[model samples]
Target: MTGKPKLYYFDGRGKMESIRWLFAAAGIEFEEEFLETREQYEKLLQDGDLLFQQVPMVEIDGMKMVQSRAILSYIAGKHNLYGKDLKERALIDMYVEGTTDLMTLIIMYPFSSAEDKEKKRAVIIQKATNRYFPVYEKILKDHGQDFLVGNQFSWADVHLLEAILMVEEKKSDVLSEFPHLQAFKARISNIPTVKTFLEPGSQRKPVPDDKYVKTVKRVLQMSF
Candidate 1:
């Protein structure tokens, strides 16, 4: 909390991307140490930096944090993005959990085989438009608020916007059927902090390409 939070992960948008989005939404600047080779990841393991032998470890407030959810909850709570009370926090958690589910699908898409990519893409788009987006759409509509939980900009909004963009990367017109989500995307994208992150030079990573996939697989010793 004194200096910027330093993030450890591969150079692409994996589990760490949501952490980046939360920091951006909270208007906090952070640094990232991208793991491009197996040695780099193994060094973290050797140093006991990774709690569960994973990346997405963050150095913040004198603690080395791993586990995406734990890191996200801390950032959100510290930055007042979690919620006002337990009830509100519960709602935020519900919305964010759903968004995380959708994001998991998109995150793994690039790792699929060539033949499976199309099938994966279809599933992603289908879930986004039908299962996921509709839920947020209804939430925004029923609440008649600018955000998903309590009508305030919180972690759920940040995660939802991030998930929306990820889905759109697979299908440009993915939000066409979800009018409220379209508006939500526009609204959240323009927040001063988020806007800066969306600009060309910010730390926001792009959708994973072949090189990103290969590097992650190599560094993590993953087959898929």
Candidate 2:
């Protein structure tokens, strides 16, 4: 924690943005090493630098680490973004897992063929915007809390909020039906560090392929 933390990931936000958000939110200094090509990432995999052979690896406390959620939780716990107690942590973990499931469905849209992508995209969009979103909506409604865990913001909320923003970029209206999540996202997006991370100057990755976006938009249409 004395020196700057180092993060390894692609320029995109696929699975690493919440880590970035955690660093930014904690006002922690970190260095980013973006893997620009599949070849570079493969080299690291072959070298065994990554335990999981993945892009989102991190070096903190002089030790390398993998798994996005673990890193997020670690950073959150360090920075007090995690819940204050064991019960709160349990609730936070539940919401975090739900967000991960939601992320899994959306991330799969790009892995299929352009034709297949659209077909699968419709189903994913239905689940994300309709099926998946409402689950959180009901939870948020029942909890009647500002965040997923308690009154204060938690890392789980950060993860879920970032996932929501990722979807909103492709199909902006996806959250139209979920007023609770809408309010939740708005609240988290206003955090000082998050606000800075979202600024135009902080965005390093270009808009990725529109094929995925188009597929996502099509999915939002729910036409299949």
Candidate 3:
């Protein structure tokens, strides 16, 4: 990858947001082609760029990469963010997988009906506080490490930080009860590269609003 990697996705944060987070963590600059219209998305499909017919296709290392996990793994490996050994990588994978489950809920929250939005919000908070946050809190407490695995920064930390912020967007006080996680969030957010990404005018996307929802639905030809 001589030049910056180019990412293909919508203007909002879908599955591609984590990819952006990983790139930021790696201190790698990239370009983006936001698919704002049905024609644009159809053109990508017509060109056969999307092997899985998905928008998160990334152009990196002389290849067009599809599938969010595969793209993330490649970037992580290239940047030495995966792990030192197979055991450490396994631990990172486990942590990343857990965070992915939490992220999936947040990603789909915008698509809920007006009536179901409140209910869904409550569900997300419940899972974050009770199911997810506690697990990470314990991991940090037991390991006494700044990161989730091998006492070093890895893909798991990047994904977890992203997940924490996304949950916080839903509920401001979501992390008040988890002291370890609160510290971890503060530490990760202050990483020079991540701090820059958090600033305004950066590539970080805001929460999905009506326009974002409408654009994504139209581009993907979704009914609900």
Where does candidate 2 have its weakest 10-residue lDDT segment? 215-224
Q: Pick the candidate with the highest TM-score.
A: 3
lDDT, candidate 2, at 93? 86
Comparing 2 and 3 by TM-score, which wins?
3
Residue ranges of candidate 1 with Cα displaced over 4 Å:
none
Worst 10 contiguous positions by lDDT, candidate 3? 1-10
For all candidates in order, the CA lDDT equals 0.91, 0.74, 0.94
Superposed Cα deviation of residue 110, candidate 2 (Å): 2.7
Clashing pairs in 3: none
Provide TM-scores for the models.
Answer: 0.97, 0.82, 0.98
Per-residue accuracy of model 1 over 111-205 as CA lDDT, tens digit each: 89999989999999988888989999998999888988877889999999999888888889998888998999999999999999999989899
Ranking by TM-score: 3, 1, 2
Model 3: residues >4 Å from true position, as ranges?
none
Q: What is the lDDT of residue 121 in candidate 1?
A: 94
Model 2, TM vs. native = 0.82
lDDT of 1 at 111: 89
